[model samples]
Target: MAVNTVGYTSQITAGFRAVELAHNKKPIIVDHLAQHLAGAALHTALADYQQLQQAQGPGRSLRVPARNRIMDDFVLEALQLLQQQQQQQLDGDGVVQVVHIGCGMDTKPWRLQPLLHVHWFEIDQPAVMQLKQQLLQQAGAATATAPEPGGADLGSTTAGSSTASLAQTAAASDGRSCVAPAAADHEQQQHQQGVRFPLLPQRYSAVPADLAMVPLAACLQAAGFQQQRPTVWVAEALLYYLPLDVACELLRSMRALSGAGSCLAATCIDAELQQAHLRLPSQHYFSTNKVAWHFSMDELAAAIGAAGWRMQGQPQTAAQLARERYGRETYVALYGGAECCFTAVPG
Candidate 1:
């Protein structure tokens, strides 16, 4: 069966929006690498974003800004919670493994590599994966050819230059030496053409799979994911695109695959928002035929608990988090009833 590209394309758009926000310096939530990975495709979305910004004036928009910020906050908080757990019980090798589901143009592995000894795996559609690999390869080439900072017009350099600079900066921040140029290039080449790219030094892996058709657990195991190791599973803004039963089944499978000390972090659409969107005369972000289901905070918690996991901390609402972080009255009016974020651990 042919997989619908709607959900996958939306994920890419979200990534593009994140890159836009990062460039504007409103809040440094997403990695700058997202901009590079998105390539020229981001220009259209960004142009729309700029128009929206202008229409709303200064710091307001038709819920776009609030939504983007909220999503970014959710991801940041989830990763932070995952890091806290890893810090408390790092393995003998001092490495943490994370699996990002439906990861479309996300730069978490690249951005977080320098901070921790992490083995990161990103699972997504084959098309998205292919495009990502190409962008990364182009980025590597650009980084290799670009002149060193202070010697040329840095603004004209490619995304590779930015990536290399980020890696070096991350290394410096952690009191470590930068990655060797030759090794970096080799690793990039190895992953560019294959399904499994063993990103050296950082240990990043990009696995192509469609969760609806294949067994996720089996795919991860084949990709070198260890069932006995403590793992962090991230499903950011992905569940709503799946049928309710399918989403629950995925959670159960994840629970079985996870060891005693593993954790899962995810985001879900609020029940009210889901219903409201369903009733709308026309859909904006998702096609009615594509979005199978959406879960409320309570529904999500129940699903997680049923899968043998314990919920940690209160469910974080996007609206509340935005209001707290941005302190704008408009947040209450725009995002007061949007989505939410949460974390869970094996019971």
Candidate 2:
């Protein structure tokens, strides 16, 4: 992939969300924002993904939104529990942190901010983050809330300010913090259209970094991630893109950075499906784009366990989630059983 290009998978994921939102009768997620951000990429990605699903079988396409909904539920549950725990600990409205690893055009903060109050951190490849920022600016999401004077402030509350302050202390020499740069003049000008995205400046931090090369903890800390705070780490559709060792270390780092009452949610192909069904199709379908599935959920779970997280339950396949919970027959046995999502908490 070109260095400037945000690559294909992120666009594809956004496209999948857009397609699901527009087409499905009972879509697992309702995300008009995804459609907005996806823009023209939606058409091409939809066509390509649909073709892949046709080759893979029916219901393959549904996996995207199903996994999304499942992960969304896990994070929401964690946020509720963590928020309550933190409130009790601090004797006030407690702050919980939600970190999205390799976040690529994700709209969770926009979707959940009104329902929950928490600090949001997004980390991703520089190219991907740049594209997302540009999209947000275009969509007027970045400038919905006016920045404080001098423009260093990035949150709407004291919790947001305090986190940014902590990040500034740690990264003062680098001139980076949990705070985002001031919006451009044009973006600020457009904000008057009564445009708003759910996450205002006060609680959202977007950091651009290549996780493989940088210290993940430092990147997050510099973005005002409080290690002692209860956090929910979301690594949706991210582990498979990384090499095995890198993925394992990523889990270890998450575990290390987390404090009490922390949890992790992730989705990946299990080793069995990798051997049973995905091995051939992955190469046939994804190789040209340079995308590859690296580690399975079992491998990831082992790493999670070693890193001090206990599995909440057996990993459930997308097919299983769709069939059992939603009571829909969106099952494709060939590859569906191989794709799985799971949640874990600190042991």
Candidate 3:
């Protein structure tokens, strides 16, 4: 296989860093550095083999492409806005039911490491989940390896998070937190010292299933869905990959399995830009190879309504929508960062 599990695993993390960096995860170097490390690790066998067989050796290590950061920032801005818009609904219950449809190796879940009380579940292709599970293990192991929590904050989240396995949502979402002061500080120093990765967490299980074809509800049940109850499904950078029909079906199935007050959040582009706006030459964007169901924003929204969903209001203020998310400079750079979302409930 041209790409093995690690290679693909690196790609997955690259994808996450892309979203994070595009939105300006500064040092900026960190994302690029992480990308290259993951890419190298993923393709080590191929790269090493090529060096022996073909004198050319492997290509330059894959790091965060410089151009992507600036451009992706706008795109991420648009996406983060859409996400924040949908995430707003997770309130009052003292529980955050969360399911990340295509979650890569993002530490948000771990960083916001809910106390044991918080239940969390991540869904992705099986291989990808394998990587996630490893990362989560690394984190937990490191927690044990590192100095124990010094104050209320340290032991608080891990001990406090309420369980709601299906949604991956935690009980008390007071805010996002993870990584120790020493660890974060170590990472910062490592960057200054030009070291590779500061430290990574143990991987949690990111379930594997191609939801594009098979309905997820069934697989979910087997994976502890019934134990968790209502789910807050969040799909970031995933819908674009599925055919519209398939996308609609997933949402419908999620609703069918939902008990009450379940929420599903996703980000999609306005199909109108397919030929025009989305035609950017950037290799990082989710183009045809990655996205099977290209669509226009209007058509997507209409499709959602057709599927019985009502678009919820966003946290849009006086500023133009995209600008508010990533600022005017980035918004313009990223083609107004066109994206939208819906938070529909069963009536």
- What is the TM-score of each predicted model, taking all chains together? 0.68, 0.79, 0.53
Q: Give the runs in model 2 whose Cα sits over 4 Å from its true position.
A: 1-6, 48-61, 90-93, 113-116, 143-193, 200-202, 272-285, 331-337
Model 2 over residues 1-347: C-alpha lDDT tens digits?
A: 23333445676667778887776666777877787677666886577556656666544435676777777787888887776676677453466788899878777776653333466787777777767766766765652233345545443222123334545644543332233333344234435655565353235667777776778887778665778778899998888777877777788899999987888988888776555443455343344245657778877777766667788889888778877777654534334445788888877
Please, what is the whole-model Cα lDDT of each candidate in the order they appear?
0.56, 0.66, 0.43
In lDDT terms, how accurate is model 2? 0.66
The candidate that achieves the highest TM-score relative to the unseen native structure: 2
Answer with 1 or 2, whichever has the higher TM-score: 2
Single out the weakest 10-residue window by summed lDDT for candidate 2: 155-164
Better of 2 and 3 by TM-score: 2
Worst 10 residues of 3 by lDDT: 151-160
Q: Compute the lDDT of residue 62 as modeled in candidate 2.
A: 58
How many pairs of residues collide in model 2? 3
